[model samples]
Target: MGWFYSIDIIEGWLPATIWALVAIAMVVLLVAQRKSLKRAGLQIGIGLLSGALGLLATWLVSNVFVVFGVSLGWPVIFAVAAGFALLGFAISAAVMTHTWRRVVAIVLIPLALLATTMRVNAIYGEYQTVGSLFDYSPYPHISTLNLSLNTISVKDWNEQVKVKSRNTSNIPKSGKLVHVDIPNTASGFQAREALVWLPPAAFAKHPPRLPVMVMLAGQPGSPTRFFTASDTVKILAEFANKHHGLAPIVVSPDQNTEATRNSLCANTTKWGNAETYLTQDVPDWITENLPVSTQADEWTIGGFSQGGTCSTQLAPNHPNIYGNVLAVDGEIAPTDGSVDHMVKEYFNGSKSAYERQVPRNAIVNNAPSHQLMILGAGERDAESVSNIKKIGDTAEKNGWTVFRFTVKNWGHDWHAVNAVFKVALPYLCERMGLGNANVDFPTDSKIRELA
Candidate 1:
């Protein structure tokens, strides 16, 4: 199913609608062909059995790829699913004597329809069209500040400007989201172009240097995934609109160079220096180019899943770079989901060396810094929620300010990720010198607020 979505053709409502129509048409045809009760019942049973076989074949193939760490692209997955469907239909037809072809149609048609329906349901109202899935947030309509590159250095700008409170009555407009290629000079790594979301507050004539948030996406994910998957931009935009357009300058940099490769956000001898690329090159690029605040306390490192795990290590390990962290569904320790594989591939057969880079070990051995962090997971995601709790507890025990929360009835997906932002962004806003504008958001017992 994951691989099936990679194909752009089946992405929108059209395919889903067509599949549903085909399913309905097949059912009608099947009923017309087999009017007798005994034959109709047999046909329906055969059709359902074939559909089940098709579904099982699809699942088995997809899971086989996953278990072997071989992810098939959309085209391959599509072909595989089609082949299995055909095989299932043929088998069902070969067995049945009367109305066998109709049975085949009943099986394959409904199977395709159900797959499309589930996909549609997952992202129905989330986006308008399939194309909108990749579309960026609405750009700021209002005119922005004309600050030149030579106007002032980041250091001078931070020292001279006072963090002014935003006007509550007047709503500031949204900011432009620009895609900039940040060169990885520090780590000498090849990284994807970073996306920068400049809030409306950054556009004043004497623009206040907004705080910086370095956000990351999960493994097999891109930087823009944060925008497309979760309503991070929308949530932040709402907060900004209420608070006179005051929001942090969010820079989403790619953690993994490729979809399949998991860098583990480490400067290992195995893969590229992803840790350095993120902690150093990313910040250096932002400071040199963008008009953002450079204070460590004003800086935040955040991500979901693999990126979240990376944030935990990046903040605690490199306190001078990022003073705060947001880890959503983060692993307790950094691994490639396999300890032995991680040790062999990245750590060069050194378990102790690998353990040294883990967040718990790093935060424990080093003297506690005044860094603040939020660790969250979905309530339904028991294992992850439990792990995140341990990570948060460890941080709190080490004298770090940590807030832990759980998104009720959600699991480790974009919905859960959005929930984290909805609840926790207010806390982030207050920390970044943007006063909470009393934005009304959903609060329930599912959100387990930890001290």
Candidate 2:
């Protein structure tokens, strides 16, 4: 099913613009009540404090429930937060008697409402906007190879990768985005459709084998989340158009099988065998079903948020499969909640097992050498930026070639994902030998400026 909505007109920019206008009106109202400064000031401070307390209470409650494996989805969480805002407004309004103070309370109520709407939009509005614009016309499945999973030998696969990597022409007009069900015959992964973004090269009459990027989405999100919000297909398309359709075959697999089930990308009895589903089943399906390069260097394991954490975890643990890793706003470890919660729920109450599953712990223990790693986050996403920088430094010290980047003026949102991809795709092109080695691209220009 298409997760995209066609209400961009109402839900995307319109509401956000209105909220900004409301904020401006609130400022004007505050200025109008400037004559009664002392009274207005006291009421405004109290109202703001109350609102903050309410939000803090909601966060505290949310964290408490997370330990019990109960996920209060964003909408419900926001509703609870809104309740607190109302309570704050009510309490503050009751104590104020002056006309200007009453007017300030009236303006603040709508201001709080507008802020809530703005927050919701910032978090999720991109999905609706892009989902609405996307062309989800079903494309016929295309597979250039007809081999069984295990039949292809190392010698032939290596030769094929070499041949396909050299071709620069014979590209199609555009690629296709299709829903695929990577059979979870053994792992019993929750039923969810994966998204395959086949580049124009994959659609040519005699399709050249492309490299593969097994991507994962954040928890409480689907594969379509990346497709709709980040414009990943568009990013790949631009890269392909520039380099004669040489782009990675990006497959965003379904990580959070159930709506509330955050498997933490592990092989756990409680959450299903997510690790097997991702590392083994995904690669097996790609190798057997698609005409994609199987050379380790040509392959990438990447994702945003939890998926990014999963990439760091999976790639290091299974270095023979994925040679390159791109993690955008990745967590430092694999976790359902706190370490204690992760241990209790998925690790059979074993702290050691929980520690072993964390990406940093696993990487430190395994110590894979010469791996290409990109650790990216938004400048505004302070925690993630800090985590990735620390992790990247550690990885580099351990003999890995790590590139750390931060997108300016973005937080932990879809725009950050797009920004990272902008730099990452070109870097991949150079690494995979898809484009001219000497010719610098605009991504290089951006990188220089960032540097």
Candidate 3:
């Protein structure tokens, strides 16, 4: 079973255990009183019912007062205080007739209140530190859920910053041009844009078209944002300068939209045709403007996060275009969809629909060509690590060539993504038919190497 399912089991049993303990305690209390079995059973049932009612009242009061921020005013507080005072007086009168009963009530009441207070405080603290829980917690179950939710929020903020920044700074100047826009196909919704890097060496004796690497951004992100935010431009420059002026042209396209949070880089009704936009439209545009190799083996595609998922999906689907696919911390499968939901969404209301789009299904049914596939996840990223391992296992079983790497203590973030890129770049370059010559480094390197 999936780890999430295991968590569900724990959630179910915890409440059951608590209730069982309450029931057992009631039974012991009645038996210690030397009550008849029938009388003891009746008392236990009434106690359980009373306890349940008290809990329900507490829940309602807490929800109405604390959660909704509603005020009961001084009048209600005074009334409650007076009522509790009367109840205490009545209990004290009854206890005066029995010393042992008084002792039991005195001992248990304070302890119960203390336990309740501690439980409340613990829950409140957990909610307060929700954002930092992933960083603090060592428990895989809690950390995974926390990180996954945090990642989505972080990505949302990052995308907003990216869209704004890219529009402001990366727009090409009319007079001196370093960047070119690849126009969209007949469908205006889907277009590819390529950014070419001419590191002075490209205009050599026999100016030859350079190799190309396509870098994809995360969900709700554009390629321009990757260049602006991440050190894509710097990395390319370093790689090019180190490889004796052999820097591949980098093409980053706008591949995310609202309909599909991830886009998966697949052709789906929810998201506009991203595959056509990237594979067909973008390549055609690149071949026209950039002096880059058009050979299938010369093209390398890589992405981070949702972009990583896209790279995995697109490379195998259209192997003729992408020679190498590097996916960094990608979701192996869509997790939110239930089996029934999957059947409805993909298969005309049938489970058979999962046969084609599911990554494992595809690998098992038809293993694609010997395209270089590199999958990496952070050791601290429980969800991503598990998903990566699942993909690796599927690939291994299917006899598909795969390279899997797990970075230590890294969660699902840019650091892990960059780590994957650093390791995968050389391998990807080699697969893209780039010569194995050592990259030449200038005595004084201008670009900052990612740590």
2 against 3, candidate with superior TM-score: 2
The C-alpha stretches of model 3 lying farther than 4 A from their native spots are 1-180, 186-188, 191-206, 258-260, 334-355, 397-399, 437-451
TM-score of each: 0.76, 0.73, 0.53
Q: For all the candidates, what are their Cα RMSDs to the real structure?
A: 7.0, 7.2, 18.6
**Model 1 per-residue lDDT tens digits across residues 259-289:** 5678889877777899889888999987877
Identify the candidate with maximal lDDT.
Answer: 2
lDDT for each residue of candidate 2 in 350-370, tens digit (9 for 90 to 100) = 788777677777778878577
Alpha-carbon lDDT, every model: 0.67, 0.68, 0.52
Off-target runs (Cα >4 Å) in candidate 1 are: 1-19, 36-40, 46-172, 437-451
10 residues in a row with least lDDT, candidate 3: 142-151
Query: Please, what are the lDDT tens digits per residue for candidate 3 over residues 1-451?
Result: 2342223211255334543543443334444556455644454454445455554555457445433222222323333333333234323323432455445445444433433333332322211122222212212221121111111122232343357543223322211114455666733545434444443333333334556677776654555444443445566566655554455666766676431355446454555666677888778876765556677777877777677767766776666787776776677753325657645653456555444556666566557466666777765555666666787677656655677776664545555666666656665655554446453322221212223
Deviation from native of the Cα of residue 244 in model 3, angstroms: 2.0
